[model samples]
Target: MPGVIARILRRTPDTRYAELADMRSGFNSLAAKVQTVLDKDPYGGNIFLFRGKRGDLLKAFYWCDGGLCLFAKRLEKGRFAWPRSDSGVVALTTAQLSLLLEGFDWRQPLDAARPRTAL
Candidate 1:
């Protein structure tokens, strides 16, 4: 399942966010906002991410399998890391998106320590 998500993200060129969005919005409203506010095609093969004003909630809108898909998450302990810009599209890589979803700082991820020997 994880591999599938990685593959999908790799194939997708546009993983973008609209800075802040209304978390109460449903699929139709988000689709409309994507079309009107961002000047983007709602049905286009791109992942659109939205963060709530409080910063703890996130919503992802995309087209998949002949239907629209919406994925939402709310951090129990911390807020999702976001870009500095207030309004506009912020492109993110698959790794960055994953880190952001896990409530980590995608901008400056700490380097993992190298192992002394390979097993």
Candidate 2:
């Protein structure tokens, strides 16, 4: 998870990323799936929002080093609190991903990210 961040893009760009920035090569099935999804669904929408049927598994795919990598996460408690289609994919940091994987609310602090000034 070095160099690459585990973020859920709240507003992913039109061109989807088959692979994230820092995914390692070899033994990565998720990346290949992501590419397939992108190839089939090129609506310029976020691929992160796409849900695969695996029962409590969330997959993220990427292409790196001339290969594909697939990332999977499973929650012991509940399903991921995915953002709305209108909001787009919500990007999360590694730490945030950890929290989200455990079914915690990762978007709380962001709601109050207002600038502060000393009076």
Query: What root-mean-square deviation over C-alphas does model 2 reach?
Result: 8.4
Expressed as tens digits, the lDDT of each residue in 6-46 for candidate 2 is: 45322334323222323233333343444463443323243
Tell me how far the alpha carbon of residue 107 in candidate 2 is from the true structure, in angstroms, after superposition: 2.4
Off by over 4 Å in 1: 1-11, 112-119
In terms of lDDT, model 2 sits at 0.43
lDDT string, candidate 1, 1-119, tens digits: 33344355455667888868889999999999999888899888788999999999988888877988787878788888888865688788888887887788888878899999999
Largest lDDT belongs to which candidate?
Answer: 1
Error of 2 at 110 (Å): 8.4
Q: What RMSD, rounded to one decimal, does every model reach?
A: 3.1, 8.4
lDDT score at residue 114, model 2, on the 0-100 scale: 67
Residue 109, candidate 2: how far off, in angstroms?
Answer: 3.2
Best by TM-score: 1
